[model samples]
Target: MDKTPSSPTAVEVLTNLVADDLKAVNLAIVERMQSPVALIPQLAGHLIAAGGKRLRPMLTLASAQLLNYQGDKHIGLAACVEFIHTATLLHDDVVDESDLRRGQDSANAIWGNKPSVLVGDFLFSRSFELMVQADSLKVMEILSHASSVIAQGEVLQLITANDADTTQEAYLEVIQAKTAQLFAAACHVGGLVAGSTPEEEEALQAYGNNLGIAFQLIDDALDYSAKQAELGKAVGDDFRDGKMTLPVILAVARGDDEEKAFWKRTQEDQEFRDGDLEHALSLLNKHNTLDDTVSRARDYGNQAISVLDIFPDSPAKEALKGIVTFCIERAY
Candidate 1:
């Protein structure tokens, strides 16, 4: 929050600011995930312990801090945000037939799909329980609607999967629903619990929505990035899964007939020969689609930062701005 040129990343700054609150959230998560059924806890713990950035929950907590919310309700709500995200990840691994998550064996890969999906459901139920405990119908409405929209987004992505002709508009719709909706709700509820003015809450929601879009855009670009491969994360997972992300969409749009045929055979048909991924990367580079995708992400990141202007300058505001920077700078 202190704008020192040599400060740690925004995420670190925010994490340190919210360290105590985050501890409470983590405790709540561990306590809530417990189940007498061994596998439920076991499988859920596996993913929870995998140590993601916890960014979504962090947004909820930070938004509460920004508004000077005095109550502890944000703690439980932040945990709820995480539960929803973790649930989606579990289901997504199963649906994507993913072997890895966060550079480790996916829950489904280790435990099988049925347990993974069921445990995801368990977490979803727990999330709603937490929401109910918050005792705010507005909060429940926002989060429950986000849950529904996320499911719909997954289905929409499934429909678009393996189809090379997927338009940018459809792709935006998918990310906005699946990713941004929760972000908007997370920030919105934070402001709501603080009794923020409608205008302030709207600003928070808009900020979060744009940040989520930029976050996902960078993630999509990273799937084909050399830096991602170097970081030991799986590159080309999207390509192997035949997922049509922005870079691929742009490449397909710009490609010649032979190139389109190549995409159809690989992405649409799911046929693979050696060097196919490399060739796909080549096409992306040739079209500069990767750079273009990053550019697009930056655009959204800027919008996120701009929306925060409604809030008075404070450490919270500065940290929120840093989050936007962190989201976009990941591409480099």
Candidate 2:
């Protein structure tokens, strides 16, 4: 924001810039998550209290400031964005039968799958409630459409999950919808509430969409590249889950017949063995898939930064740009 050579991390910078407003968003989240039914709030609070970067809400808040928005609506809307994200995560853990979230036991693991899923439902409903309370049909439309797209993305990912033949185009579609749409909506809603021009709003959406893509790409690659502590989960969690992320896809494409057979056995047939993860890493490095996947993330990160050219210089604008860097640099 200050054009300094040395700056704190992007989230750190944005956290400070929007500190007061983020506090309000947190308060709103706490208030809305409350329910007379004890388990509803308990399970919901578990995940909310679990450490997350809160990046999506930050995007909403940052985008609002980009347009010099003076209103407080973005705070509530930002919480709505987080609720939608948390709801999806809750449902996703149930679907994936995940054991851990944020390096801790998943809600589904602590509570039964049914409670987890039902609480996710509660959160989703609460998100709509917040959107409606904002009193903007356009905001509701955008978030509702994003919710649909995210659900569709989940379905698409499920269909493509174990199949190695899934194309890059199909995978991108999944990430764009599953991960990026909410990000786009979060940023777009900020601009919309601030009454930014359509062009400016679209730019904010583009920046957020690209940032989300980069974020997901890095996450997928990190499943292979990072350590348990650093990644906040097992290194081969995706591999163990038989999830067909980009690195595996690329490795499968470039691999020889034996490698292909291995991927088919492990990923498709789920016939995983002890050294499977090591073999998978070997193949990924041999094909440079990890580096290439990260390169792809960098491409998207660069696009995200480029679109910020539309916004005039401000601390929020610079912090938004820094977020792109933070996302891409995660691989390193």
Candidate 3:
């Protein structure tokens, strides 16, 4: 149940490696973002130019290096992953009706929803163009499948939203689809480009999948634990949006009749007020769901590191392990 800050060893290693590749990735993003489509160029630039952590591209680059890849295609492919991730963010903000992302106004919030949606579509098409240009059928298949999984996960969440009956297993499945699939694909594609042995490719894919799960679990934990200002959004955003995440699922699952009624009213009543938020938080605290969620996040972090045991001891492997630790320990 420990939620204390862990060392940032792994993420730092990955960060250093990816930092070196930023020049190429940034160039690719800048080049692709320029469009003759007028509004597309403007909106796409706004989102891409906003500057993100570039973690998706970093995963791709790190995976290639881990397998000793020497080809130049990794650069373009890495940028492609980032483009896809950014596009998802655009659509996600619209769906969530969210105003802020990464401490900045979301594209949908700044622009009208129609324009934001079209720009997101533009990014999706642009990403595919980049992947096709790389001419790796394997890479195309990986990203295409990841995109479908992400969409399916989003749909699944939409169906389950505000439904108190949502189970922990169902929630985890959605996360795997919505988030971890891309991470797995990025790392797996890196191995494929490097021509790594089948075993090595599988190991990297497993590592990425587990790492993604750990990263998301921690993110869910943070939504409950992080300060609203530091988290760059209102606290209990999930609850506010009628989304049942890990914490609420745990709390409601173990709750008594009264607590269950509270959650049910929030979901089915459609008349819930702000005080409901406080009531839900108190119930979750009373049931210690936050601690349970943190424990699960830690378990996933350990599982992510275990997948890296197949790789030989090297800077890449060490960084991969550190990323697992950093995902759970990151304060933001």
Candidate 4:
């Protein structure tokens, strides 16, 4: 239960295990992001330096390690995974008109929409270059297909946004495409580099997919959780943006007529007044949707952990299990 910042969480454990590989990935990311244009690196660097957990790239490194991979191929591939993720973040901020990212000014906020979009595209191109360097068509296909799926997921989310009538299945589809696809691909490519058996590769991809879903579900819950604000993270960004996440979806499904109207006004109509967020939080709490959302995430996390049972007991296996715990427990 190492939930506090003072205690190393599961991700930290995995990070420590793959510290050297992570360093190589970081170096590759920095080297690949450079450009004579100056603004490209500057804007991209702003977000890269903002310090995310680098979880996706870590998955790449850890999956390769789990399969006993000994080559440096995973290094460039991990960096490539990161570039795709970073590119999405830049575009996402622009689309969301978000002012802050990772607790600082977003790239779009600082550099404007045009530069953020262009730098995101630059990062994407750099990711493709790394994939080419890998020189494996399977690896290229996995990562490239993930990039496409992620784009489609973002578009799916856009279509579902501001619509209170969005179904839970649709929400799941959105997260699966936008978020889980890359997680699956990251782990899949790690095994590919190791020449893993098809079963092992499938296990890794399933593990990553379940973990990613659990991760995003917890995130959706955290958006309305009081704990988020206490931790200095913005608590109502999803609500304000009218993003139809799991908690909201659950709340809407379980709400009364009056509650439904409130959601429709705030979410569908994008209307807001003082205490609207507070009301939304209260409604979510009243329906117990936030807790239920976390419960659903725990289910996914369990599936993620079970998939790893296919692998023999090893530090890599344990670290991967810890990641599931980290993903689910972060809501606290």
Candidate 5:
């Protein structure tokens, strides 16, 4: 019952920058989503209309500004980052067979899986087109590597699902690949665009890696704690999908014989019966696994902030710090 309020330091100052970039990103999404074919346009439009935080693009823009970037390529690069993320979400919803996203029907659920997938592919292609326009070999290299790593990470997550034997090490690898790598690349490229020194680029990369890890940890924690209405999806969506995240893995490892049996029955069994999800929640709460996960998230957030020390304090630096704080502090 500690309800401490978190401070703003990181991305808060970048509101205007994010706002401006978001307009460009949104416009780019609309233009890229367009198809002469009607079906693809309608389907892509649905997901595009559903509002998301647009954090990846914000990271790209903010990082570039912090390094004193004064060019237009950052705008295109930021848009490309958002497109990449949107493509991943479309594909993920199909894989998860998810019904809800951002309190709206998921693209896969609304448009059916096939069109959702094709639209995702279209977005992927559009993202590349934008990258090519950036005309920076280093930017192209960074995003290409990130896109490939994200796909590989998706496959790794698919492999781990329903496998109760998944270790913390294995789970961390999935997260680093699927989530953190793109975050790292997004910020790293911002530095790249600004022509930052090697050391500074590495520092931004480290900040993003840690920030991405922290972001994912907080997301997993919210799955258990946040209300369905607030989370825009059900509480046990991950468990229902047989997806094993950090909390479940940690809870399973720390749980006793009875708790372990409960997890196996709910998460590993071919068919989960009535009360399975409730029992799993009980085990997680009793063992304090959620709290432990949040603690780890805070630790990573601290590490992310530490990476900012290399940059002199400024509005951009403050915005970067606020982003870290908001990642941990948000209710949904």
Candidate 6:
């Protein structure tokens, strides 16, 4: 978890390897985002252009390429995955009332909530349209299940939002649904599209599921450790928003009666005071919870790497493996 960063990042290498294919995906994205009403594309493109890593779609491409997929169905499928992801972000920002996304004003912050939600729906319908066009029931099944699970994950998170009693297992479940499910679906569809054996498909799904969980664990840690510039959002956004991520949950579990009262006051009650964040950090450090959380992430990272053993050697395979290290290194 504390390893030095790689010289040439996995993202750089992966993007370079898939440059041509990614261009196709990008073209598909731009083409599909069009609307009779200008604002649909305007609003959707704003977030799409925001310079995030586009990690899920990359996984889709890399996984398919590893299996040596020859057709262009994956490109359109990758675009559909991006649409689902972007739509979720739009709805999430509205729900979270977030101001900044990837260091820019959130769509809801600029365009108003109604448009944000509606545009999200538009993107969702567009994703479904693409799903239908792909003409593979397997692909449709995976993405549609992922779509449903993502919504379920959001609801589960809402259920646990401010409850201090939320267990580590429960938190993992929430992330799996809201975040990892898509990652898993994206990779799984790649294998399916390549006509991989069911076991290989399952292995890819496992790789993605574990990677997605580790990815989110880092985000939970970053909410405290990363500076605003590094994270592209204000620190303590989770705390101020009363989200009970792992660090807070760890501190809550290990905190003394007084510390528990402090967390309860700020988190459960949403009554954050000036030094509350500092105190939260102190509690997290005192319990070594932050590093411990990353430690769990590392364990999952190892799982993601080991699952790739089933695949024969290829550049795409190697890059997918690099992704595990890159994900952990990013947390550092």
Sort all candidates by lDDT, best to worst: 1, 4, 2, 6, 5, 3
TM-score for predicted model 4 compared with the true structure: 0.97
Backbone clashes in model 2, listed as residue pairs: none
> Could you give candidate 1's per-residue lDDT for residues 1-332 as a string of tens digits?
68658868889998987899999999999999998899988899899999788899989999999998888999999999999999999999999998888878999999999999999999999999999999999999999999999999999999999998999999999999999999999999988898899999899999999999999999999999877766557889899999999999999999999999999999999999999999999999999999999999999999999999988888888988999999888998
What is candidate 1's local distance difference test score? 0.93
- Candidate 4 stretches greater than 4 Å from native: 1-7, 230-232
Error of 3 at 174 (Å): 0.5
Candidate 4 residue 195 C-alpha distance from true site, Å: 1.0
Model 2, 290-321: lDDT tens digits are 99999999999999999989888999999999
Of the two candidates 2 and 3, the one with more favorable lDDT, higher being better, is 2
Per-model TM-score, in order, reads 0.97, 0.97, 0.94, 0.97, 0.94, 0.97
lDDT of 3 by residue, 124-174 (tens): 888999899778888899999999899999999998888999998899998
Model-by-model lDDT, in order?
0.93, 0.92, 0.83, 0.92, 0.85, 0.91
- Superior by TM-score: candidate 4 or candidate 5: 4
lDDT, residue 29, model 3: 90
Local error of candidate 5 at residue 320 (angstroms): 0.7
Question: For residues 44-140, could you state the per-residue lDDT of candidate 4 as single tens digits?
Answer: 8888998788999999999999989999999999999999999999999999998888878888888899999999999999999999999999999
For candidate 3, give the lDDT. 0.83
User: How much lDDT does candidate 5 score?
Assistant: 0.85
Which candidate, 3 or 5, has the higher lDDT?
Answer: 5
Model 5 regions lying over 4 Å from their true place: 1-13
- Give the Cα error of residue 226 in candidate 5, in Å: 3.1
